[model samples]
Target: MSIVVNLQSKAKPETTTKLISFIEEKLPAVRGFSGCMQVSICLNRDSGDLLFYEKWSSKEAHEKYLLNIQNNGVMAQLMSYLSDPPTVNYYESLDI
Candidate 1:
């Protein structure tokens, strides 16, 4: 089943611009990874928070890629740039 991951983080207000810029700059590499169906970054309509919406071929595929050496290394670097821990939720398409 196709998997969707929704992630959000609390960031320093000034950092929002930088954060979005960083995500935009780095997303191509992520989307190019194996099994990545689609990826999008958007500002939360209500909270003005950063949101990452990603679709993968499967939950297993997403986990596998996250554990892979290359992506894991990149993830480590990305984590360091955040001001607070991020929240991640996984879901599968039910009707659409």
Candidate 2:
């Protein structure tokens, strides 16, 4: 089953511009990753918070991507742009 991930983070007001640029640079890599169905970035204009919505082929696929990111230090580099820790949640699509 496909999975959806929501990642939320707050950027320091002063770092918002840098944060957006950094994410934009990295998005293509994310979109090209194996098992990545789609990905999007959203900004809360008033709060300057960032929301990442991602769809993956499966939980295992997402976990593999996470491992790859950790191994390549991509996660650490991304976290450096945030003022606070990111909040991540996963959901399985409901067939209803």
* Model 2 steric clash pairs: none
Candidate 2 per-residue lDDT, tens place, 1-96, comes to: 899999899877887888888888888988999999999899886887889999999988888998999999989888887888989899998777
Model 1, span 1-96: residue lDDT tens: 788988887655656667677777888877997889999877753465667899998888777777873555777665655666779889986755
Clashes of 1: 0
Give Cα-based local distance difference scores for all models.
0.75, 0.88
